[model samples]
Target chain A: MNTLQLDLGERSYPIHIGANLLAQPDLYKKHLKGSLTAVVTNETVAPLYADRVVKTLESLGQKVKLIVLPDGEVFKTWEVLQKIFDGLLECSADRKATLVALGGGVIGDMTGFAAACYMRGIRFIQVPTTLLSQVDSSVGGKTGINHPLGKNMVGAFYQPQAVIADLDTLKTLPPKELAAGLAEVIKHGAIADAEFLTWIENNQNALNACDPKAMEHAVRRSCEIKSQVVAQDEKEGGLRAILNFGHTFGHAIEAGMGYGQWLHGEAVGCGMVLAADLSVRVGLLSEADASRLKKITAALRLPTVPPKLGINRYMELMSVDKKAEGGEVRYILLDGFGRAKIQAVDDALVIQTLQAAGAG
Target chain B: MNTLQLDLGERSYPIHIGANLLAQPDLYKKHLKGSLTAVVTNETVAPLYADRVVKTLESLGQKVKLIVLPDGEVFKTWEVLQKIFDGLLECSADRKATLVALGGGVIGDMTGFAAACYMRGIRFIQVPTTLLSQVDSSVGGKTGINHPLGKNMVGAFYQPQAVIADLDTLKTLPPKELAAGLAEVIKHGAIADAEFLTWIENNQNALNACDPKAMEHAVRRSCEIKSQVVAQDEKEGGLRAILNFGHTFGHAIEAGMGYGQWLHGEAVGCGMVLAADLSVRVGLLSEADASRLKKITAALRLPTVPPKLGINRYMELMSVDKKAEGGEVRYILLDGFGRAKIQAVDDALVIQTLQAAGAG
Candidate 1:
């Protein structure tokens, strides 16, 4: 078992990664504030791991309630987020009642946000059941629902009590979902660690096969890089903008196609490719480095090309992104491997890159 | 103008209380991050002060968009709150865009919560027009919308950049609303300042007539006491709970009668009366002091009696309150004048108090 602590002062929490940690009841006992606990998951994960978690909480004498929301990124909206509130209120969950998020990024985001808002605020644990969530969403305290205008447009930077990433759950993940998770894993490597990117390129087969050892390193390294950046800038004031390297373009893809059309990591994967192209145009990166990043993304089975959302549509979508300041979309470009920069480029340059990528 | 600072470390902000402060552009300029600013008000306040605020922002070279929501507490729901988001999105408000809450408590809350959640968070200024908002809601960082299940069931504790409490706006306030605002002014005196309570008791005429000097002192002192308590415990971990002196019972009455039926301060006024009765029953206060508090509440023309909701219904309502822990309702009882205590009392005693008040 490997544990990493995300240092956020009083809001800091531990991230537990290992095999079958969900079956270990002790990981949850310390975080439970009261007798009542609500395990919030989606329909898909509920059928698989809900009972194991419920029995574990109940063994410790907790009155556990299972709230199963519909699964998918499309369900990440205020209307659907209200269901979690409804379930909690129906059971009379109080300020001290703990919520355990037991699914992927969508579930973790919604439950964490629900915890942030329920009675002003409450405690919640992130029990991520997917690779994308374990590596990205679980570590950061960013919890929120998306609006029709943009992805993750409404939410809070609320930290969790702890994040339990049970590797055993990844054994059942579909190949496509595994690829989506790899996108973020690649992002961590591309922006912060050059050697890690090389390692990913060399270990494509091991990752695709979901080898326990390789998966563990991937998740750990990804969390380490992401947590360090988050620790420095908890609220995305300045330094944290680097963490949104491909998000400006990624969010456009997600919103332009309507959420759920492309998995978040998938859109982010292709968005990275577009961002690298923009990096080359802006004289920040060599074409060879951009090509290398693209090759690595494609080798992992994630999409390397964005959908044909058109120049105007993509620009419109990106302008509403949270990273945009004063209506000017700021692009997070790769200055070089292991380094990133955020700046606003000319719209003409952005359009040229989009046209080259066939997205214009 | 009288300026008081709420010391919340990095999140600290100034509360400016005086006549015609809203028309002063300098107050808004220092806080605004960018050119775009959204003025969020309700229908009632828009016709009264929206133009003045917008003109002020426009004069400072701000591109202002006015978002008018429906008036009343009933509209303090997520559904109605969405309108603010819609307005912001329609205008392409970016991360640096500022939101000015230009009404009473409802506008301040929804706008503050909107600012808290919009793109994770944004900047907002509170221009409280109502006396109740000027004295209470604008000072604290508590921002949220209500649910069918409870008042403020979902929201965030987001601080505003500044709170502009214009005494001039109170001139247009209705007599009942003025009395409602007095409830909180009276509460600050009862729970934290016995001298202020005595002053309130002696100056009912000036307060009733909305005299500038009396109103200024009332709002300034309330902000001082509330900000001090908030500075010690911003998230209500312990010391801040005392600030909710009558909120537990008050929320029950508001929810029991359906929101918007009784103005929040009116319900709080009556709830304070019930809490005083409970304090007497628990041997925490003398019957004479309790009667004195009730007399002061009634003298301000605020309701001193709770509606007959029956003991069971009141219990049900209070249990779901944010103060409740693990299904047990924690009552904020008066320790004596100018002090408060939180504890779980026997259900039988609560029932007896309710019966005695003719609310059973």
Candidate 2:
């Protein structure tokens, strides 16, 4: 087991990395301080893990209630949030009832959001099931549902009481999803740590083989980088924009294709490739570095190009991305591997990058 | 003008309390740094103040867009919050657009929530008109809306860029609404400063007659007390709950009677009376002190006895209050005016207190 703590003063929370950590009942017991613990999961996760978690919570003298929601990002909406509230009321959970989010990014995001809204705010634990959630979404406490017009359009920067990412759960995730999760792991390297990028490139086979130590290192390093970024810019005031390295274009792709059509990390993976290519065009990144980024991502089986959505539709969709500054579309282009900067690029350049990235 | 600062480091904002502050275009122009500003108001405040504030923002080379929403507390829903997003989208409001909340608490809460959710967050200014908003709601930055099952079920503790509380607007307020707002003003005295309570008691007639100095002192002292409390406990971890001295009972009244049936301040006025009566039952307050609270609230023409809701309905409603911890319905009991403490009394004692308050 490996442990990393995000030092955010009172907002600080610990991230635990290890195999079978979920089976450690103490992790569940420690974070949930209330008498009642509500488990929020999607249809997929509940059948597999909810009972075990509930039994653990019950053994700790806590009453457990389960709210099993529909799976997928498309279900992330105000109506779904309302359902969670209904469950809370029906179960008679109070302000002290701890909400435990138990699934990957979709479930984690929706549950974190549900906890954020439930009773104005309540204690919640993130028990991420997917690799993407374990590496990225589960740790930082940014929770929200998507508005019809935009992705993550309505949410709060609410930190969870604790995060427990059990690597054992990843064994159950599909290969495609695992590849998607690795995209974020690679993102952490490209944006802030060239050494980590090299390490990922060297250990891609081991990571694909589910080597425990290698996987834990990837998760811990990604969390450490994100923790530092989040601590400095908890509310996305400035430095936090770097965390959206591929998200500006990624969100546009996701929204353009409609949510649930592509995995978040997969879209982000393609967006990063295009972003790197654009950086090369703009002279901030070397073609060699861009090639290195692609070779490593390919080893993980993640997509390196956006699906064929026409450039005009893509541009219009991305224009509303929260990452855009002052109505101008921007990208978190790399200055080189391990260094990134936000740049306002012209439409012509973005269209050109799209053409190159989408070219066969 | 009286200025009180919240002192929350970078989140700190000044509460400007005085007559004609909002009418001055310079006040709006000085704080708004960018050219794009969106004034989010409701139907009630649009015809009343939006045009005037828009003219001021426009005069300062700002492109102003008015998002006029439907009025009422019940309208403070996610649906309405989405409308603000829609309006921003319609206006093509980029990150540079500053949201100016130009109305009472509902508008401020909704606008702040929208800003907090818009692109993760945007700069917002609170132009609080009602005394309830000016003295308490505007300063705290606890922005959210009610749920069908619970009040303020979803929200965030988002601070504003600035707060402009113009006292002159109170002149046109309906007598009932104005008196209701004074409930919060009186509450600050009861929870934080005995001297302020005495001052309010001594200047009852002058305050009723709209003495500018009395209003100034009332607003400043109230803001200062709240500022100190909020500084210590940004979230309701501890001291901030003292600010809810009357809120537990007030929330029950609002929920029991259905939201908007009784104005928020009116319910809080009654809640304060019930809470004071509860204090006597719990052995923290003397009967004499309790009577004085009723007298003071009555002097301000605020409701003293909580409205008749059957004991069962009150219990059902109060149990769901965000303050209820571990199924224990705790009330903020007052030892006397300007001194309050949270206490868990037996259900029997709560019933007796309500009966006594209703009779008194």
Top-TM-score candidate index: 1
Q: Model 1 compared with the native: what TM-score?
A: 0.98
- TM of chain B, each: 0.99, 0.96
Candidate 1 residue B187 C-alpha distance from true site, Å: 0.7
How well does each candidate superpose onto the true structure, as a TM-score?
0.98, 0.94
RMSD of each: 1.2, 2.4
Which lDDT tens digits does candidate 1 get at residues A1-360? 999999999888899999999978899999998898999999899999999999999999999999999999999988899999999999999888999999999999999999999988889999999999989988889999988877788899999999999999999899989999999999998889999999999999999899999999999999999989999999999888887877888888988888898999898899999999999999999999999999999999989888898899998788778877877888999999999888999999999888999997
Instruction: Encode model 2's per-residue lDDT on B1-360: one tens digit a residue.
Output: 877788888788877878778667766766665578889888877887877888878778888888888988999998888899888877666776789998889999999888877766778999998778888888988898888888887788889877898988777678788787789988999988988888989988877776777777888888889999998888788778999988988998998889999999999998898888888888888989888888999999988878788887788888888888888877887876678787678999888977776631
CA shift of A126, model 2, Å: 1.6
Model 1, B1-360: lDDT tens digits are 999999999999999999988789999989999999999998899999999999999999999999999999999999899999999999888888999999999999999999999988999999999999999998879999999998989999999999999999999999999999999999999899999999999999999999999999999999999999999999888989887888888999999999999999999999999899999999999999999999999999999878998889999898888888867788999989999999998888888888888897
